[model samples]
Target: MGYVKTTFLMAAMTALFMGLGYLMGGAGGAVIALVMAGAMNLFTWWNSDKMVLKMHNAQALAAGDRFGLVDMVAQLARNAQLPMPAVYIIDTPQPNAFATGRNPQNAAVAVTTGLMRSLTREELAGVVAHELAHIKNHDTAIMTVTATFAGAISMLANFALFFGGSRERLGLIGTLAMMILAPMAAALVQMAISRTREYAADKAGAQICGHPMWLASALQKIQHGAAQIDNDAAERHPATAHMFIINPLHAHSRDKLFSTHPATANRIAALQALAGTMQPNAPRMRQTDMGPSTTSVPKVRKGGKRGPWV
Candidate 1:
């Protein structure tokens, strides 16, 4: 159902873009807009992950890093039956994380230093699993496309506004309305698609981690921490705000129509409901009877040492 909704919304966004183009320059303009949107999406599909990581200055973690963060991701990846993804640590105090890649094979997971220091071992696992779920479900790719289209639509609106597009075809009043409402409509559609994927990712993350309560607990902490700490990187790149496990931007409107992620309280309630259905001792993975062994697990550093947040 989520995918279906996302598909419909994406189509609507495209139609909106083409319509704006027609309003601006007739059939020729519509064709040009469609080509530009397609080209931009293709470019974003190939390079968005790299661009996002670089924007946040994420540093890749080595497999043998003493912090054992990569090791933890390794274990979770095994449980999720996903190929090991490149892990990165962001140099920020905000407790947050996100996943990005075109597909599972090329995926990457990044967490802020604040997240590591703030969350417990179990809570961290839950967070990582949630990001991995995004990779497994290919949400990153879908979101990139959505963003690309949204951006293109906004640009088209701006172009029309500045140039007084097709003034003869669309009266001055009609052009003014397009300039004001077109970008707002694009934003609404983009936010709706983002909200839908977030719920699906939450459900799949809980299943992958085998502990709905773990994520529920993590979300609570991250939400509180994010509210207190300002992420400069997120502030500068508001468009990428939707990629995070929690909304990293501050001063968000309470209206759901404008919010990116689902409300944290509502998300926690859903997880708590999911927890009610699982057995108390149910194993995390259903594919294998045997549980993950701790023999190879590395000792995570204890004490409040402020190491890099990976």
Candidate 2:
């Protein structure tokens, strides 16, 4: 159902893009705009991971780094039956993570310094598993295409506004309508697709990690931490906000219409419901299973001082 909805939304975005093109230059313009959109999507599909990582100032994690995060990610990838994705760390205080790539084999997972400092070992595993789920399910590819079409639509609208639209086709009233509503329509379609993929990723991630509660707990902490600490990179590049596990932008009301991620509370509730069906002991992580001499899980406190994990 989620995939079907995403497919429909993506098609709507494409149609909206072509409509704006037609409004700008009739049928010829629509065809040109579609070709442009296709070319742009192809470029993004091949290079988006590198572009996103560079945008965030992500640095590669070398094997010699003693933090054990790379090792943990390796284990999770094996569990998901995916090729090991390149690992990176962003030097930010915001507790967030995202995955990018055209497919599982070429994927990269980047987490913030704040994320490593904030989440417990199990919670971190859950987060990594969630990202792996995105790679496995090819949500990255879906989102990249959506963004490409949305961007192209907005570009067409901007061009129409500046260069006097196709008066022969749309007239004054139609041109005015396209100028105001086209970008908004694109945004709506993009947001709908993002929210749906987030839900699917959460469900699949819970299964990959073998523990819904772990991700639920991490989401709670991440939501709280993200609200308290601003993610400068995410703020600067708002279009990339949907890529993160949590919405890294400033807090918004629970209105699903304007938000990139589903409400954290709503997502947590869904994960809690999933947790109810699993065996009670199934989600517990053995400390020894983590590499040697790893720190114990941090006890997160609400509205209190930062813990030792940070």
Candidate 3:
């Protein structure tokens, strides 16, 4: 059902993009706009991971690190039946993470330093699994296409002001209205698709980790920590906020009508509901299987605060 909803929303976005183009000009103009959008999105899909990492000043986590994050991610990747994605750590105090790549094979997962300090080993696995789910689902590709469509629609809407042909088609008043409503409608659709994908990822991630409660607990802690810490990088590049597991641009406020990510509370409630259905003897990934050192002893991070994550 979730996938069905996502497909329907994606189709709606495409229709809206083409319809906006038709309004801007004619059938020929629609084709041109779609072609232009596709060309633009190709670049986005190819380099989005590198671009996002650079923006956040993310440093690659080398293998055999003392913190065991690299090894832990590798174990989780195997559990997810995915290739081990490149791992990175950002310097921010915000406990947030995001995954980027066109597909699972090319994916990279980046987490903030604060995340390492905030989550237990099990909670970290949950977060890693969530990110893996995004990679497996090709969320980066979907979001890039949707973003391109939204941008192209907005561009066409604004271009209507200068293009005399558009005025002839929609009339003066009609063109003005299109300029306003087209972008709004496109934005709404984009938000819908993003929200839907988040839900799908949450469920799939829980399954990959074999513990829905672990993710639920991680979400709460991350939500609390994120609200207290401002992600300066995310604030600067507001456009990329949707990529994170949580909305990093704002505090843990109530879910808004057009928020990029689903509300943490709602997501937790769903996970809790899922936990209710799992069998008592189901196979579960033990936290010890991740790395040599357990979450019991808080490994002091060099050049950072020396304390175990709660």
> By TM-score, highest first, what's the ranking?
3, 2, 1
The 10-residue segment with the lowest total lDDT in model 1: 288-297
**lDDT-sorted candidate list, best first:** 1, 2, 3
Residue 81, model 2, lDDT: 80
For residue 10, give model 2's deviation from the true position in Å: 0.6
Estimate every model's Cα lDDT from 0 to 1.
Answer: 0.85, 0.84, 0.83
Which pairs in model 1 have colliding backbones?
113-309
Better of 1 and 2 by TM-score: 2
**Per-prediction count of colliding residue pairs?**
1, 0, 0
Model 2 scores what on Cα lDDT? 0.84
Residue 219 CA displacement from its true place in model 2, Å: 0.3
- Tens digit of lDDT per residue, candidate 1, span 235-293? 99999998999999953535377898888888888999999997666547332222232
RMSD of each: 4.3, 3.4, 2.7
What's model 3's lDDT at 204?
81
Please identify model 1 stretches exceeding 4 Å from their true place.
Answer: 162-165, 251-255, 279-304, 307-310
lDDT of 3 by residue, 170-220 (tens): 889988998998888888888778888998899888988889998999999
For model 2 the local lDDT of residue 287 reads 60
